[model samples]
Target: MEKRVKERREGLPELPNAEKGKVILRFAPNPNGPLSFGHGRGVVINSQYAETYDGKLILRFDDTDTSRKPPLPLAYEQIPEEIEWLAGFKPHLTIMASDRIEVYYEHAVKMLKMGAGYICTCSADEFKQFRVAKSNCPCRDNSSEKNMQGWEKMLDGTYSPGDAVVRVKTDMANKNPALRDWPAFRMQDTITNPHPRKEIGSKYRVWPLLDFQSAVEDHLQGVTHIIRGKDLMDSTRKQVLLYEHFNWEYPETIYWGRVKVHEFGGFSTSEMRKDIEAGIWSGWDDPCLPTMATLRRRGIDPIAFRDFWIELGLTQKDIAVPLSSLFAHNTKKIDATAPRLSFVRNPDAISVGIDADERMSSISVKSHPKEDIGMRKISFDWNERGTDIYIENEDSTANADIGMRLKDWCDIGPIAEGFSQMTSLEPATELAKIHWVAKGGASPATLMRPEGKQLHTIEGLLENHDFPIGTIVQLERVGYARIEKDGNLIYTHD
Candidate 1:
């Protein structure tokens, strides 16, 4: 079953109306923070389709909302860097909505002149009553000239925040009340809540809502296809209405259901930002978090992410998966090259007696069991009587009467006061295979594992080697880890 799954090609379903070299897709993230694991699905699917069709992928920052979900300053650069890291190439085109405020404004004026939109001065409660009654607010019947004057008031700060808003004209009696004259643009007090961008700070009091901004940009950029979540189908409906007002064609859109990674369920970028500010987490790259930066720092290959998502394919059915499912893909990508080493946690010393003439002083084992990656030698502190080795304290307390084998080294008969070395290299019968390091031949190291919002550090002794920082190595009987600059290890997976 596993082999069949692996044999399947890693690609997404063919996009509808997609043409080779002409299919243009986009990934427009709000840039509230760095990309999360949920965001990765969109990135990978769009990137894979773009590559498959030999088309262009545009990275657009949909950062028009400055009051509710404000954009972070560092995200402008961090998001692009992450996209490059994951896709192995930069996006063909990059755009920021905040910088295109003028374009959105121009479209607003055009919509007003054509009587497709009107400025409403109704309060939130009054608008809700009107929408509930399937009726139009008093401002909805104003003439185009009157609406234009209201729009000018909005731009010139004549209307305070929430005093007036531009609403796109849609059917008031429409069954879905949300579609009835949805908000197109609103006023934001730039002094109390300024945009993060220096060039955009307090420059314009009127800001376009997401539905309006994204619709205009999609049409302007000639986006051929749009892939978004099913929750935003209403936004698509709203945008389609606006598209009709301009007599422009709406792009082919595909919607996917929410994917709930069991480990990162219910984690939002806003909550993460607050936690990070409170110092509950280190930063975006904190291993405990599920941000792309954290995944990269933990040594997950970009290919693994790509393959994982492509295998899931495009679906509207909501799916749930464990993090280990992703680790399985990474293990396949890295196992062949990750060198094997020994690590003993909570080590306890045990002496094994060997005859001077029959025992070897050291043993050299293949760095990888099935690969020609070279050999690593384990030196023993052999005296005239015996050699001392360190094993995990848990192993020392285990049943040792049957005997055990020091992996890749030698077999031991039994444990009385100490262990008695057996003559045979291989055990005659089944025995516990233990991973050990020669005393004085290992360095003290710490393995940090992220477990349920907490980072647990296990102090251990790792076999001495000059493995470069960022090298992923499998510790014998232990899981894989990436070597850190300080000679510690960050646990990757089992």
Candidate 2:
């Protein structure tokens, strides 16, 4: 299996210009909500490279867009926790961009004084026209001193939101208009849209965009490598230009094509947040959501989750995969230790009459088929006629005529009343093997199965076992599930 995975991944390539114990990698995420499956790729890939080189991994929160993509207060704590869970270690340094507004302001002032940045009072429409015409905006020719004056106005109340923006001086004739003079800093109305952080709430209105903030942060942190999605290549192009202005060496960048998990393709942090506000989901850890918390709640081993992405490696070709791929990895990691139990959904009761000589009072079954995990004894209550047991409704009458083996117990066949015990302990080869729980040993259970956006519940009876809460167990014919509570089980996967 290891060999197959290596061949499939083609092995992760060594980082360029990387030195042992010198490489520094970072995973920057917008802290709007808990990290989802899409975000895990960055965390895993960057952390893996950091580990391979014995380097430092930094967790940076790009939470400066207080108005457009406001940072959720809870996400401040959730992102680091999720990263630690996925990476198997806490980052060497955790920095929040919101905490360093003054640093960004200092850089902005330096850029303006160096004649590489200008404050533009042009409306968005006016700038778009200039960009489309491949011509410079009027503000491009402003003197550094004049731009600094406008910058002060932006920091104060003189320039309202959208009335002024600081633009990075780039070529207006650049083939890609988006690569033209892009907005680096803008004024925001903190009064109406205050930042979630109490200390930083409405502190200042002038804010730096992602490109400016991230570029400066990466340089300051001495990041040696950056692993980001291919969609952000334009960000790299823009940042490279900014680096040229500062005469800074840009980090080696690696890009992976978008990985669209078939099950979670429709999920977005913003949309999920809106739904969560409307009470559409239970919370970030809801069973149906594709969040790290949800996966942890469903009993997905963190090692398996990490291995799943590591095996995928890095590629530029966009790939779509099903959730089953991850489930397969998880099964291998947990199956050997997951206890086997009987859970009959939509249970149907049946009485099995037994001959006096064939009476079996109790049956002991191994909790694990191939391991010495101990045994569970299921006792039967016998009457003058027969003993009662419960089996899945679908399996009750399917092979009555041919008879069926009550797993770990004797064989039984249809009779006038219900079923009659067979004399032979070993059933015929063609006989169906069905799981059953003696009436006395059955406990009510509810199995929650997540199918896309909907969570379905299956009422059933689980064999009375001593497995503690959070235990991952495999139901005979059903799939693997986690014991959420006394009578609750959340289905993980088949």
Candidate 3:
């Protein structure tokens, strides 16, 4: 692992000496959907930083928009669940933004009285058009009384959804487009919650912007240091402004760039969720995804993930590291720990002229080839009256010329019938390296498919080879496999 990388990354600016006691950090995920791998990175990074400084980590759900696609707060549960599952730790506190709507409005009223915020009677489309064309709204200079009346109308459900919104009223000509008078609260039915707010029938016509509410909420929660993706680094000014408006101390911020697109295309956590919901992939933990759970399911060690993540360190410049590095690093780490087992995917059985009923000829195979490990005993002979022995079509063909080592036995050349035949195995072992037997008395072996199904098979060699459970050994020219249990094993190309 890169110790220097972690040290350097953590060497960021700390809270000022005077503000040391107020060290609070928070991770606000709007549990609108299942937690994604990218979010996993954020959770770990933020929580680790909080722990480093002995600060409290608050797991807050920014579930302000109750009108989300998934109306239920999947995040409230999934966020904490995924964080615990991946980080092996939980936050000091859990809060939902919906629960704090009163607090936000109370603060919003303060801003309104300060003349820093105003309610506009602009519709959603009008606001969009105004924003696009840089047109100033007539409500921009409306009297405080008029704005308060508009807010009252919003509270009573007298105004329509798009009839009014509360804007921060920042400069439209600000150099940063994001700082250009962004909306603090808006009337919308993004998600309709039946829960009463300030009054009955008071569906929040004015919803607080995530960044704005987050700033105040984080301050209230006493977050001292905030870590976020670089994509959001640009919002620092506005957030800082909000903090100033609330007369609250702003938290120190650390920004890390987004994870690179290792493949030819970019697939973010958000994009992956969309695809999964659209039935493009299996689920959030789909092995093809870069999610933490998916990595775990794919047998990728957590330590390897941490090492890889820190190796990149905290940088403002986004990077596109090659995918090969991740795979290779995982392979090297698992080589020493993961147990070895054999699996032939597409089976091809052949008759061998070996001795029948020969129990005296014991085959002893080492559990792990690289280490001096215990061995397993095997008794191989003709299959009752048949000479059939199964082997992977891919391995059989690849080693056809350079006969493969038959576990603790002799190396034999494959017959032309194996891969050379018209309907036989291909020239390479790619066709079938993972083959298994039906369950009988043997331990249950599992074949974890790409779609997330686990097919339990039997534990035993296709030929005379024998290897004990939890043994890290090679399949004699085949790839690597981890003996999950006595009956099942997980195979990887590495």
The Cα local distance difference test for each model comes to 0.89, 0.90, 0.61
Error of 3 at 202 (Å): 9.2
Superposition TM-score, candidate 1 onto the true structure: 0.95
lDDT agreement of model 3 with the native: 0.61
The prediction achieving the highest TM-score against the true structure is: 2
Off by over 4 Å in 3: 1-22, 68-72, 124-136, 190-205, 264-278, 355-362, 371-377, 381-387, 398-402, 413-493
Candidate 1 lDDT tens digits, 378-444: 8787776688888887876684676678888878777767656664676655778889899867999
lDDT of 3 by residue, 1-494 (tens): 75564444343344444243346778877565666556756776666566566667788877666444322344455567777765567888888777777788888888888878889887766766666667677788888888788888877778867778788877666667677667787666533554222332334556787877888788787777777887787677888767667678777787888676454255655566688789877776654666665666556655665556656667777778765666676777777654344454555565444434432344455656676655655543434432445666666666565454444344344455542221221234333233222112123234443322333333434322344554443444555554444435554434
lDDT of 2 by residue, 1-494 (tens): 35453444344788889999999999999999989888889999999999999999999999888877899999989888888888989999999998999999999999999999999999999999999999989999999989989999999879899999999998999998779999899888899999999999999899999999999999999999999999999999999999999999999999999898898868889988889999999999999999998999999998898889987888898999899999999999999989999999888888887777667778789988998878889988988767888888788768666678888887877633465666467766667889989999989989999999989998999999888999999999888999996558999999
Regions of candidate 1 where Cα sits further than 4 Å from its true position: 1-10, 358-361, 417-423
Ten residues in sequence with the least summed lDDT for candidate 1 = 1-10
Model 3 earns a TM-score of 0.77
What TM-score goes with each of the models?
0.95, 0.96, 0.77
Q: How far off is residue 242 in model 1, in Å?
A: 0.1
Point out the worst 10-residue segment of candidate 2 by lDDT: 1-10
lDDT of 3 at 306: 57
Per-prediction tally of clashes:
0, 0, 20
